[model samples]
Target: MAEDSSWMTAGAGECAPSAELHPEIAHPARIYNALIGGKDNFAADRLVAEQLSAAVPETVAGAKANRAFLGRAVRAAAALGVRQFLDIGTGIPTAGNTHEVAQAVDPSARVAYVDNDPIVLAHARALMSGSGHGATSVTRADLRDPEALLAAPGVRDLLDFTEPVALMLVAILHFISDDEDPYGIVKQLVGALPVGSLLVLSHGSGDLVTPEQAERAERSYDPAAAGIHLRTRDDVARFFDGLTLLDPGLVIAPHWRPDTPPDAAADRLGIYTGLARL
Candidate 1:
């Protein structure tokens, strides 16, 4: 993979917001980190996270489950011979990262991790040190503009559009409301890839949660801020309309090719995940 300045030098003058100062008051990324019991979050993040957790303990389980699904989906696609991966909305890096999963399956695998959160970028870059020197990189970009994320030098420098690639949209599309055209955004990304490319995704769904529970979770976030727009299973499945789903089609997080079913299948955790090939 070729080195690019988009992450270090080029992004300095670019228009993008970061989580450097830790806007704990209403920071979703930090709150999510707190829910996962990570130390990188602030007091405000913890407060919101605790409240949200009290509203739904299944959230914590679902977060970890979604991450596990990401690893499983990545490894599965790698087994299919896809070497390059473009991970969009990669939240604050947890234990198993994109490059780690892909590279574990194949040493030469190249991955580009993109996210708008400054904290995610900071931690992800630090984690990549000494390991994926050239194979893995972190860039600042929003999911709303898949084109910008795809065009980011860190992405283009390593990934070749002519080859099959995996477009990872794990646990982030729920933040994007219907008005933002989340479906259109995904379609644009898939349209850019080659024939054998894959679309890896996980979305928040009201399918598993009761009406009151789903409403409570949605209201937990500040309406002005990014809200979790929980969709029905059918609506969630529509995001992958043109593509062919992998073995476990649009199932709940744990149901989609789980290593071991965690004995909590009936209690829906408001998340649905699936992988599809183009």
Candidate 2:
């Protein structure tokens, strides 16, 4: 790994939003942290998480399943000899981070994590200290801005554009509404990479959740947090367009190459996940 310590010097001013942290508002990352039983979230995040859990009892389980699917996807990519990873929308650093899983499989693996949340970067910096010095770096960039995210110093420093990279979009695409041209966003990011690159994605689905449950969940994030837009399985499958989907294409989170026997309860999580290669 080459030394590009410039990414270290670039502070939040360079890539992060200038707005102050609003503890009163429920952020998607913090709420996800709370749902995963992490202690990094605040009162507002916990409140919204709890409300969603009450409305959709499987919501918590769905979050956990999504994380597990991410780990499995990363490991599978590593097995395929893909060493570089660009994980956009990486929530609060939890147990199996992208760099952790990829590096475990191959020590030389490099990961660039992109998130818009300042708190996530704060925790990530602390977690990365004294570890993964050259192999891992975090950047503040929104998925909506593919050019800025692709050009971010951290991403440019850690990942080689010429090489095969695994682009992980786990549980993050839902925040991007149709108006944002989520499909075009995916294509733009994928287009920058060379052939043989992989796209690993897990998205929230409305196919399983009842209309009432979906309405309640959307209401929870209406004012304070980023709005939720759960798509159908067919809609999510469109994300892998023109790519080769691996076995068990576009299934629920836990069903995509699970290490354990598929749990019947996982089907209720309302998340569609898949791994595809260009």
Candidate 3:
């Protein structure tokens, strides 16, 4: 596959449900792109992502680390012989997408990516098309609207709800506020799946950073994007209430069965990651 992507269509933007969605706002996905040094972001998103990066200079690394964890987690899910995947808050596409990783482990893997961003929907759909790609789809919808996401036409077409599916929520929880009932949202989403399903999730953390730094980062992301509610370790762990946490439990990112040995890569393991089986 020729990997360099152009916009799924030049008219994709104008053709979206509405043309009023301001491209000027600093959305989470675009901010993330800025942190990763990608060109898919707007100037506003770069400003905030940079501000947060200044507070925790590792914000860039933090974002990249979360992405790395997503890949490792997806591969782990496929290794369990679980071939269906439901990836929510699917950020702007880059290296190692859930379908790509899952399909790499099992060519027959099926995936459905959900996101509220039109840009993400457009790009992901482009890559997921054509044959020999397993079965993959993209849904433009909110995480809070789990029902809508689950009901999306493409989701129905690709994933069988009756089977064990890996539910991926990497680096997206923090963007969802408690007021939005993120916990309830997760519970309902997981509740919809059958037994042996998995919830492979990750969240940004404020544990190692000073309170002031965390607050500054939060303030930096406020004007646009979901306001950051960088949770404590226990808080992050709360998202996995009903499921059994896999070995190593909920821990720092670099600590989760890291590709690198324990002592050598200890310093960068600040992001919290976990793979739970339901």
RMSD in order of candidates: 3.9, 3.9, 5.2
For residues 1-278, write the lDDT of model 1, one tens digit per residue: 21122453223222333535546456667777777788888887787777667777688888778878899999999999999899988878887888888888898887877877777777776665553444776787778887777787777876889999999988888898989998998899899999999999998887776788778778787767667788998989999999999897888888888787668553567788899999
TM-scores for all candidates: the values are: 0.90, 0.92, 0.89
Per-residue lDDT over 187-207 for candidate 2, one digit per residue giving the tens place of the 0 to 100 score? 999999888999999999778
Ten-residue stretch with the least lDDT total in model 1: 1-10
Best by TM-score: 2
Residue by residue across 141-236, what tens digits does model 3's lDDT show? 778777777776656666788899999998888988878898998999999999999999898878888889888988997634468778889998
What pairs collide in candidate 1? Answer: 19-118
| Model 3 residue 119 distance off true place after TM-score fit, in angstroms | 0.9
Please, what is the whole-model Cα lDDT of each candidate in the order they appear? 0.79, 0.84, 0.78
Q: For candidate 1, what is the lDDT?
A: 0.79
C-alpha lDDT of residue 120 in model 1: 75
> Between the candidate structures 1 and 3, which one is better when assessed by lDDT?
1
The true-versus-predicted C-alpha distance at residue 97 of model 3, in Å, is 0.8
For every model shown, the clashing-pair count is 1, 0, 0
